[model samples]
Target chain A: MAAFIQLFVSGLATGAIYALVAVGFMLLWQTSQTINFAQGEFVMIPAFFVLWAIKILGVGFWPAVGIAVIASLLILGLLFKRAIVDPMLKHGVLPLVISTIALSIFLKEAVKDFYSSQAQPFQAMIPSEDLNLFGAVISSQSIFILLIASGAVLGLNKLLNGTRLGRAMQATAQNPSVARILGIPVERMIMYTFLINALLVALASLMISPIYLAKFTNGDTLGLAAFIAAIVGGFNQVRGAIVGGLILGVIENLAAAYISAQYRGAIPLILLIVVILWRPQGLMGRAEERTV
Target chain B: MMDFLTSRAFKGRVFVLLMVGLIVLPFFLRPFGLLLVAMWMVHAVAALGLNLTLGYAGQISMAQGAFVGIGAYCTGLMTLAGVPYPIAFLCSGALCFAIGWILGYPALRVQHHYLAFVTLAFSTLVFLVMRNEEWLTNGIYGLTDIPRPILFGWNTGKAQDFYFFTLLMTSMLAFCVWWIIRSPWGRAFIALRENPVRALSLGVDTRRYTLMAFAMGSSIGGFAGALYAPLVQFFEPNSFSLTLSLKLLLMVIVGGSGTFFGPFIGAATEVLLPEWLRIAQGYYLIIYAMLVMVLMMFCPTGIIGLGERIISHLRQKKISSERSAQAQAMGQDKVAQTKSDTQGGAGQ
Candidate 1:
């Protein structure tokens, strides 16, 4: 019973992180009608950036977090304009897709080559306190990660439902041509989508800094998991991503705990394939038609 | 037809003869250098095989690396079981073809990026299996102590002899590819890639052709992999990762797809690019990835595309000059037309 409770809580936290990443994936997908394979690379940028800041700039955790988000957005703007938006102005999804894969490789290789050779734990940011719930023992860091992640979802929900710009984002995602006909600046909206996705990645990196040590390949694995969750949730739907993340997290944890750990990653992928074969759309996605 | 044969046919045959003469290169070239070229030729042949699917048929496959791994395993296992070297090599190709045909079933439904995802998954699964399946693969230690591939009554364990063996097999495959492309099956693949609906309307079975493409491409990869096991005398899961698959794609894209000689150029570029950038070793991977991007963007059609553009440009300019000359010498042009009328072949 205690093991079950322990699994449930940790699963929720991990799911929360996936949901956050999925949300970022949806943000870009929604606005531009293309998914960034480099989206997960954005997640690592913040963790590394903040780590760099705390060590070099000597800023406290909160201040370092603020600076990291800012720097990421600035760099994101440049890449969004130059690498992505400009060349892709008149192109199909193919070049953009291939370029993102290239970009992901670049980001990963750069981190591996230039950054610290050894993996570093966020000892400075993560508190070492233990919190016992019922018969299970949990960490303060785990609770904090969960709360912060939940808070982000809540805040994003409010922004999407309440703000004028948020409506413009939705409008652009729903129908780019229609939005253009209706006088919305579609390009600007897409640029903003990239910004928001990068910012979310920064936030996710900061939130998850406690438990998982950030390494060059950490983003690659997390990004793949989140991407799978995003697909399971439905490619373009934000709510679906969040739900998908939690469900996958629980399934993964339980599978790992009960079955073999070697094939832990394979469980969700198998489920995803089966679900896709059944639904052809996702668990929560709109039923899509195939031309063939 | 006779005139056509006498013209470029003479030149083309001469070129082939010259190339065959160059095949005696191992006598003069060092064994190590010959081996290097031999290995590059193997990859070149494999990439050409991939081009039939990825480039010509427009199916982006990521399991080429896995197929190579399978071929290597098959070769190693067969050799270990005391099978003859030639039979082991042929059996590896056949086994990989079967695997590819089975894989092509689900792969027919998926297209573009989604198809890439599934193929990528296959490669990853194969990688994982090779790492964890101790009984079969020895859990990443891989099959070692394999014997070298040899021809009948000929020991090809030496670098020079093995290089010639590899070269002969590669040349034979290259010729086979050329012959296959000249057939209706190759046309079907190209037609399917360019327009599936049109090809279907014209009574082409696209699914079968796609499967054919996958099988053909994968068999070539297997052939190369089979040869590679004995040549290197070692195998590991790390050697057949997704990175190798990506590099194969890069070779096809950078060298030129569709054209016969493009894969050779691409294979050369892929193998030599890093060696050329030896000084900037730390930035080799980043530079390589960036080069692929730039190549994809500017030369999406690859070396053939750029070359075609330049050749067409020159041809167009030359034709225009002749037309202008005719305009300036209208009386002489009229006399030449009468001469053609007297010659009786008016159809041309």
Candidate 2:
């Protein structure tokens, strides 16, 4: 029971991070109809930025995060989205995807060249004490990560549900042409979606960087897992990303503990194949039929 | 000039030029260069497979590297277990063909981006399996000392001999690809890519043809991997990482997807471009990434597409100029007739 609880709590924390990444994917996919393969790079690059600020520039944590978020919004959200994805969108789905993959390669390689290719330590903003809850010893960082991740989700939900800007974004996603006719600035809304995705990924990166070192390859693994999470949950739904992420995280933890550690990595792939085969619409996704 | 260049006779001339280039290429380069050429052929085999799925079928598959790795390991292990190299190679292709066929089931259910992620997940799983199965694979320690291939009782252990052998295989495979692309089944694959719903409505077996393309593509991947083993003599999980798969995709795109010689051009770029850009040291990949982005932006059709565009542009230009000249002559004739009519009226 103790082992189970411990695994569950830790899994929840990891899932929250995965959920954050999945939410980023959902936002971009919803707005642009293109998957930002560089979404993982958004997290990784910002995590490195925070590392640079604190270690090289000798800044405080919050200030470092502030700088990273701004930089990510500018470089990843605006510049990358405008330059790479927007133009590639005109070509076709495959070209758009290939361009994003190219963008990811650029981000990863740029980080490796500019920053240290090796993993760098990053300090979490939260305190480092351990708390015992129902036989599970939870780290302060894990608690903080869970709170912050869930908070971001709730915050995003509120923005999407309760705000004019959120509604405008949704309207744009529903039909850009109609939204344009209705006087909603569809292009700006799409830009805002990219910015929000950047901010959310930066937040997630800051939350998880202390647990795992800021490494170039983190985005590849995390991005892949988050993509799977979004797909298994439902590519079109935000709540599905959260639910799917939690399920994936818990399953991964349980599989690692009970099953052979070697096969732990295969869990998500197995789930993905099963989910895609059994339910292509995903766990909570509405069936959408694309017309010619 | 453009018309002559695009003529069927021009194609034969180009083919003969390529044949001459292939025959004389070994003598012009050192052993290392010869080895690079051999590796290029191996990668071309894999790129051809990718082209079938990504280019011809319009299906996304980032798992080509993993499939290649599976084929390599299977052949390597079988040869170690005393199987003949040729039979082992065939077995490897068959195994990957089966895996690809099974993967096709889920592939049929998903659309473009979904299919991409599925292949990504499948590749990750293949990597995990390759890394974990120490008993069968020797795991991270990797397989070493695999004997070189023997063809017709001649040991292709020498660099030059191996190069020729790989070249022969690449040509045969390339020919097979060309035949397939020209066949009815290939047309069905392209039809699936162009319009799945319409193709299905038109009596094409979308599911079966897709599965066939995926399986055939994967078998080619396996064949490439099998040939790859004898060339390198040792490999590990690192050689078949997702990065390698991405590189294969890069080759296909960079060389121009779907074109007959596109995979070869892509394979050559993958094998040789790095050496040319090696002076940049740490910045080579960054430069390469930027190049790919710029290339995709400006020329999404790859190298072959660029050539086609140039030829077509030239043809259009020539035709438009000739039409203008003819119009000028007609205008002069009308002016002459009008001058005669005006003169006659003045005389009256």
Candidate 3:
């Protein structure tokens, strides 16, 4: 009983991190119709930045997190404005696909060049404290990561429902042309969507770095998992990302425990494939009307 | 001479000349390395498979690596089972084609990125299967000591012999592609890629075609992997990872996605260039990326496309000059006619 509960909690914590970044992915994808394949790199690059900030700039953890998030958003602004947003505006779908892939490669390789290519433990935000809840061991970092992930999701929901900018973003995603005609700056909304994605990805980095050591190849695995979360959650749905992440997390954990640890990585991925095929709309995602 | 120059026969002559030139060009370089040549052939086959879906059917796929693995593993198993080389190759390709067909149906319903993601997941699934199925793939140890393919009692275990064999296989596939492109069905495939909705309006079943494209592409991927297995004689999970898939995509894009010789030259450049710069292994991939970007920027049409453009431009210029010279000659004739008319009038 204790083992199951512990595994479940760990899974949820990891899933929560994926969901957080996946939320950002959903937002960017919904608005721009562009999925950043390098999103995991974005999640990973910030931890490296945080390390740099602490080691070189003499900043503490909290301030380093803030600096990493801000700097990451700024880079997102530049990358979106330059390589992505401007060039891909009216280009055909193929160019958009190809260019983003190119950008992904660029960012991933750039991270490797900038950081120490080997894996390393990141600076922890909290001390090593295990909390006993229902006979399961929960770490301070896991709880913290869960809280942040949940808080971000709720915050995003509120922003989408109540705020003017979020309303405009929703409007752009639904119908960009109509939004544009109604005097909404749809292009800015799209660019800001990227900004939000970067912010969320940075937050994910801050969350996961405590457990999963920051490494160059971390992007590939993290990116793959996040993509699965996005898929199982439904590509366009915000809430589905969280649900999808949890599902993926649980499946992966169970597989790791019950099956070979190496093969465990393949579990969530398989489940993701099955889900997408069975429910193209995803668990909580809106149903896309079939054109027949 | 003018008549001959204007005839279609001249075009055939040019094509033969080009083919002959290519055939004789390889002897010019030393190292003339066969292992690298075989690698290029494997990559070329992968790129061609990608082209079937991406270039022809207008679908984006990230499953090239998975399909290649399918082929490699299948080939490995068959060789282990004491199967003949030709039978193993055929079965490898067939297995991949079946998988492609199965996946194509569900995948066809999704749009661009979604489809790409599904294939990504599938590739991950493949890697897992390859790495985990200890009985089949021998787990992480990989299937080593696979025997070299024998042809006419001549062991192709020699590096140069494998190179020639791979090159021959690539040529056969290229010939197949040429035939497909010139066929009506090929036109239908391109039409579907260019505009699926419009193609559907013309009674073309886009789903069936897309499935066909996937199958064809997977078979090519399998063929490449089957050849790849015998060349290296060792198989590992990393050999067919997501990076390989991404590299194939880079090859397609950098080589100009929709062209024929693009894959040929692109594969050579992508494979051999890294081999040549082995000293810079530290920054080798970074250099490879920058090179791809440069290629994408300046030579978006690829080497073949650029060459085609240059050839067309020269032809156009030649035609324009001929037209001008003809006009000048006509003007001279008109002048002479006027003078002759005057003379006739005076005689009258």
Candidate 4:
């Protein structure tokens, strides 16, 4: 039972990061009508940015995090405009999808060549000591991650529900033509969605990198896991993504603990297949209608 | 422009040129180059299979690599078990066809992105199974010493001999694919791509056609893998990975999806360009990735589209020049007629 609690808590911590990434995907897909296949790269590259800030500039952790987030937002926003938004708007979805995949490859290769291909250690935000609670041991870092992740989600929910810009973004997402006709600045809103997505993924990377270590390939794994979370919860729903991430994280952790570890990597994919087959609308997603 | 490409004489010329190129290509290249060309042909076959699904039917899949892997292992194990090479190859293709057909069942339920993920998941699962299943796949140590074919007393042990044999097989499959795409079923696939609802209304049977496309495409992938296994003589489980699958898809897109010669051109570029760009050292893949992104951005049609664009642009220029020449002649005629009228009036 103690082992179970430890596993469950660790899963929640991991799930929090996945939830962040999943939310990024959900927001991007909703606003842009295209998913960023390079999202994993976004999760990965920011850690390297933070690493550079810390190692090269000799900055403190909070300062490095700030610099990394700012740089990533600007660079990714510009790249989103040039590499994705422009061409994607012109060519449509398939080409955009292909380009995103290319972007992913480019990001991976760039990090491998420019940054160290080897895994780099990152410092945890909190103390490295473990906390004992009711026969279960948890790290201070895990608690920190859970708290910050939840806070971010709550903040995001409030912003989306209460703000004018957030409502405009939602309007654009629902119907871009209508939003544009209503003078909602649909393009700018979409761009802001991209910016927010980049920031979210970078934040996720920063939060989890201490435990996972900053590796070029970490994004691919975590990004894929997050994607599964979004799909399982509901691609179009924010709360669904949050719930999905936690559920997936707990299930995957339990599976790794109880089942054979050799097949752990296959667990999410298997779940994805089952979910897709059984419920295409997803567990929490609405049944959408479209005219031909 | 489309008409010119589809014209009988033009197609015949293309056929003759390709045949000549194939016959002459082996002479100029070294053994290593020949080997690469053989490998290119194998990939080209797989790309053609991908074309059937993605290019024609408009269903995106990332499982071609896994299908190929299954084909390779099935043939490898069969040959190792003392079965003849030809029978083994056929059996591998048949198995993939069955598996692909089954995969189409799930495909019927999902939308586009969902389908992509399903295929991706299926491929990952296949990869995991192949890696973990020690008894059958040799568990990442991989199958080795797979026997090459001895077709009608000709030994295919040498690189050149194997190249010719593989080339023959690739050409046969290529021709079959070409034929299939021009058939009524191919038209249905195209209809399915353009508008599935309309296709269904017109009694195109989108589901059956999609299933057929999946089955045929997967079988071709398997065939390519079967050919690949013996030619290389060794393949680790990772050889048929997501990267390879993405590369195949890249070839199709880069070469010009939905076009007849796109897969061949794409396959050639993918196989050969890396070798030529080896001077870039460690930065080659980064450059390649950038190139793909730029290509998708500006030249979504790939290399084949680039050629078409040039040809079409030239044709338009020629047509405009001819139009201007005719206008010039008409203007000159008007001037002459007016002068003649004035002269006649003066004479009167």
Candidate 5:
């Protein structure tokens, strides 16, 4: 029971990171209808930025993280929008999808070539101390991750639901032409979505780097996890992504412990197939009517 | 001129020329070159199948490599177990057809990126299974020394002999694809691609056609894999990874999706270009990735599409110039008619 609790808690922490990435994924899909195949790389790249700042530039941890976040927002968010997404989007979703896949390869290869291919140990923001809860020991890092991830999600929720900018973003998502007609800057709103997504992924990178390590290949698994989590929870809903991420995290940990550890990666994939086959609108998403 | 360029006679002549090239080229090349060209043919078969699926039917699949892997493993294991290579090859194709048909169920439910994810998940799962199932797949150790096929006392164990065999097989497969594309089913697939809803309204049975596209495409991929097993003689699960699938996709896109000759050109570019780019050493893949990104950004329709665009643009220019010349001639005729009318009226 204690072991189960431990697994559950750790899974929640991991799921929280997946949830953060999934939210960003959902935002991109909502506003621009882009399934960014390079999203895992987005999470993977920021850790290197943080690493570069601290190791190469001799910056402090918090300040390095700040530098990483701002840089990610500009390069990954703004540049990605202006360069890849804006140009390829008009060609339709398939081209955009191909472009993103190409972007993923580019990112992966660039990192392996330019940065160290070897996994680098990342510094944890929180001190490494065990906290006892209900006869299960939990790391302070996991606790910190959970707190920060939830806070970020709540803050994002408040931004989307409460602010005028958020409403404008939502309007653009619903119908870009109508939103533009109503005097909202549709392109700018989409750009903001990209920025917000970059911010979320950078945060996710910081939270996950210590646990998973900062590695070039980290994005392959992390990106797939986010996709599975988002789909399982509900592709369309932010809340669904959160629930899905938590469920996936807990399930993956349990499967690793109780089931065959070698085939643990297969578990989520099987879950994905089942969910796609049985409930494609997702557990939380609504069935959308074909617009045309 | 355009009619001649697109005519059956011209295509037939091109086909004969290509066949002659295939038959005679190996004589001048070394054994390694023979093997590379043979590998290109094998990948061309896979890319051709993917073209049918993604290009013709507009279904997105990231699991083409997985299907190819399934074909390879099935043929390798069966041939190892004393089954005839021909029988094993057919069985492998059959297996992929059934599996791909079942895989198409998810496609019926979702479209675009959702479908891509479903296939991506499938490919990953297949990879995990192939990597983890030590008892069946031999895990990371991989099955080895799979014997090449013998056809009517013709042993294709030699590089030159295998190249001829692969060439013959590729030509047959290409013929089959050509026939399919010219058939009513091909028309139905185009309809499905252009607009599924409209196709359904027109009673095209979009569901069955969708399933057929998946089955046929996957079986062709399986056939390619079967050929690949004998050609390479040794391959690990990593050979059939997502990278292979992406490469197949790259071939289909670069060559020109939906065009009959696109896969061949695409496969050549994929297999040979990297070899040519090996001068860049470690930076070859980075260069390749950037090239693909630029290609997708500027010419998503691919190399074939770009050629077609250039041809059409030139044709349009020619037509416009001819039209202007005709208009000038007509203007002169109009002036002559007016002068005659005025002269006749003055005389009256």
Candidate 6:
């Protein structure tokens, strides 16, 4: 029972990170119909930036994180819009999809070539300390990860649901032409979503790096996991992503414990297939009305 | 000129020239070069399969490499177990066809990126199984020394002999693809691609055709993999990763997605260009990735599409210019007639 609880808690912690990444994915899909295949790389690149700042530039941890976030906002968020997204927007989804896949390869190989191919240990925000609750032990780092991830999600929820910018972004997502006719800057709103996505992925990167390790290939697994989580939870709903991520985390951990550890990675993929087959709209998403 | 360019004669001549090149080129190259060409043929076959699915039917798949892996393992294991090479090859293709038919179920439920993700998941799953199921796949140590086949007393253990065998197989496969593309099923696939809903309204069985597109495409991929096993003689699970899938995709896109000759050109560019670019060492892939991104951004139709565009443009220009020149001559004749009439009126 204790072991189960331990696995569940750790699962939730990782699930939180997956949720953050999924929400970012969902935002881009919702707004621009742009599925960023490089999303895992988005999470990956920022952690390296933070690592660069602290190790190479001799900055403090908080300041290093700040540098990483700012860099992501500028380069990944803004420059990404200008260079990759804006030109490809007119072409349709497939071109963008291909470009993002190319971007992912570029990012991965760039890191491997320019940065170290070896996995780098990242400094966790909180030092490790074991705490017991209900006969289950959890680390302070896991607890920190959970708190920060949820807090970020809540903050994003407030931004989207409460703010005018959020409503405008939502309006743009529903119908870009209609939103533009109503005087909302549709393109700008899309850019904002990209910015928001960059920020979310950056947070996820920082949170996950310590546990997952900062490596070039880290994006491959994390990216797929986030995709599965988002699809399983519900591709259309933010809340669904959260629930899906938590469920996936727990399920994967449990499977690793109870089932064969070697095939643990296969669990989410199998889950993705099942969910896609059974509930195409996802658990939290509504069935889209098809129009001719 | 435009008519000749698009004529049957021009295409037939091009085909003969290519055939001659294939038949004669290996005589000049060393064993390694022969092997490279054979590898290209294998990849070209796979890319052709992808082109049918993504280009003709407009169903995107990122699992072609996985199908290839399945084909390789199936053929390798079967032949190792004393099964005839021909039966193992057929079995591998059959296996992929059934698996691909099942994979098409997810496609029926989702479209575009969702479908891409489903296939991506599948590819990853297959990779995991291939890597982890050590008892069967040898768990990364990989099955080795798989013997080459003997065809009617023709020993294909030699690289040059194998190249000829692959060339013959590729030409046959290409002919099959050509026939399929010209058939009613091909028309149905094109319809399915242009608009599934409209195709359904037009009495085309979109579901069955969709499944057929996937099955045929995957079976072709399996055939390519079966060939790949004999050509390489040794390969690990890593050879069939998402990277291979993407590389095959690059070939289809770069060569021209919908065009018949696109896969061949794309495969050549993919296989040979990298070899040439080995001068850049580690930077070759980075260069390759950038080139693909640029290609997608500027010329999504690929190299074949670009050529088609230029040809059509010139044809239109020729037609328009001819029309204008004839108009100019007619206008002059009309003016002279009017002048003569006015002169006759004055004389009267």
Q: How well does candidate 3 match the true structure in TM-score terms?
A: 0.89
Encode model 1's per-residue lDDT on A40-121: one tens digit a residue: 7878777888888888999987888888889888876456656654665455555566666777777888888878646768
Candidate 1 has an interface RMSD (Å) of 2.4
**Model 2 per-residue lDDT tens digits across residues A155-174:** 99999879999999989887
As for lDDT, the candidate ahead, 1 or 5, is 5
State the lDDT at B141 in candidate 5: 80
Q: Per-residue lDDT tens digits of candidate 3, residues B178-248?
A: 68767876788898888888899998988888898888888899888898888888989888888788778
Superposed by TM-score, candidate 5 places the C-alpha of residue B58 at a distance from the truth, in angstroms, of 1.6
- For each candidate, the DockQ is 0.38, 0.72, 0.40, 0.79, 0.69, 0.73
Compose the digit string of candidate 4's lDDT tens values, residues B1-348. Answer: 545864788979998998888778888989899899898899999999998989998888989999999999999999888998999999999999999998888777876788888888888889989999998899889999999988799989898889889989998998899899999988999998899999999998889988988899999999999999998889988898777887888889989999878999888877877888889878887888888888888889888898888878877887888899989999999999999999999999
lDDT: worst 10-residue window of model 1 chain B:
B1-10
DockQ for candidate 4, C-alpha atoms: 0.79
Query: Which is superior by TM-score, 1 or 3?
Result: 3
Interface RMSD (Å), each candidate?
A: 2.4, 1.3, 2.9, 1.1, 1.3, 1.1
Off by over 4 Å in 1: A54-61, A123-126, B1-32, B313-348
Summarize candidate 5's per-residue lDDT along A27-104 as a digit string, tens digits.
Answer: 999999898989999999999999889888899999999999999999999999999899888788877877787788
Give the higher-lDDT candidate: 2 or 6: 6
DockQ of 5: 0.69
lDDT tens per residue, model 1, B1-348: 333333567659865885676587788877666766777887887798888877778778878888888888889889888999889899989988888887676567657755666676677778878887888888778888888865678888888878878877888888888887879988998998888878889999988988988899899889888888887778888889877786787678667778777788789876755666789787887887787677556656667677666767777787788789878799787888888887766656
How well does candidate 5 match the true structure in TM-score terms?
0.95
Q: What would the DockQ be for model 1?
A: 0.38
Q: What is the C-alpha lDDT profile of model 2 across B61-124, one tens digit per residue?
A: 9999999999999989988888899899899899999999887876788878888888988888
TM-scores for chain A over all candidates: 0.93, 0.96, 0.93, 0.96, 0.97, 0.97
lDDT per residue as tens, model 5, B298-348: 888988888777778878888899899999999999999999999999999
C-alpha TM-scores of all predictions: 0.88, 0.96, 0.89, 0.96, 0.95, 0.95
- Model 4 stretches with alpha carbons more than 4 Å out: B1-11, B334-348
